[model samples]
Target: MPCVLTPDPTAQETPARPTSTSTSLRDRSSAMLREHLRPTIQFLLVGGVVFLLDTAMYNLLVFWSPSHGWGTGLMHGTPLTAKVLTIAVASCLTYLGNRLWTFGDRPRPGTTRSIMLFILVNLIAAGLQLSCLGFSRYVLGLDSVLADNISGTLIGQVVSTSFRYVTYGRLVFPKH
Candidate 1:
């Protein structure tokens, strides 16, 4: 008679496929990420447009020398004023874009309260930008356009944008 091997009953077995629970958990995590990421992406796109607009407006107000004009800018010798004006306009655009697209799915709060909070948050963000600009202009005494752009546009914006992103989601557009 030919010898036959017996099956071992004590062997450990590895799963050939993922369990349904694990797969469902992964799917849920992916969906949550997409939901959050979509708004962030939209916010950044809107911010990009607003940034370009703000840059153009600021440059025009601070550096533009018209053919028939003798001044270096419409707001010559007043960089701070120009920055304020540009920010004001950009704030309006930012509000509309965030409301209509970025946080569109969020529940709407009272219009008056929401607008007030939005303004307050923007004021704080603007203060961050202004502080950088002022430091570059007054403290550091760097008055050149290059210095202004580096401090106000680049550095300042980085700080302010970070603040705005966090505050806008929490205060202005609560998920609840």
Candidate 2:
């Protein structure tokens, strides 16, 4: 047989790579990382949405509460029930957004299982937050009410939210 006349080797090399034998090798290395990274970025974006929504609602409530008589001076401290209620509303908003958009694209076994895992993972986070709140208020003796709220809600929320993100990404969203 005659030797094949070919185009440029370098051009062929790069373009051929698309359907290439080497693609599997490159893909093999990247498969795990891509699987891991995609959900992470998605979750972070969802978290951003939730944060903005939650913060806006919370601030609005605070601003309006004064008209209803719970102003700064009248409000010596935010009650736990109020805090919990705010979080509960925010959490519902987050869950709805997350379920509809964030992890919605991923293949799930079923809504029940997915929701169970989602709630369980987040409950751990919620517990961590409450525990932190208890610690800061009762154990650490943080006198300034605002300071205690920051230490507890802000710090604890960060930690637990991290846990929620990882667990939901890896476990709740099953591979298709």
How many steric overlaps are in each model, in order? 0, 0
- State model 1's lDDT: 0.89
- lDDT for model 2, please: 0.64
Stretches off by above 4 angstroms in model 2 are: 1-29, 56-64, 68-78, 143-149
lDDT by residue for model 1 over 1-176, one digit each (tens)?
99999878898787799989999999999999988798889989999999989988888888787864433777768898999999999999999999989998888967787789999999999999999999999999987778888999889888999999999998898888
Give one digit per residue, the lDDT tens place, for model 2 in 65-131.
5456434423235534444555667677767766767777777667888778767777777777667
RMSD per model, one decimal:
4.0, 7.6
- Please report how far candidate 2 places residue 139 from its true position, in Å: 2.0
Highest TM-score model number: 1
lDDT for each candidate structure: 0.89, 0.64
Which pairs clash (backbone N, Cα, C closer than 3 Å) in model 1? none
Error of 1 at 125 (Å): 0.4
Give candidate 1's error at residue 140 in angstroms.
1.2
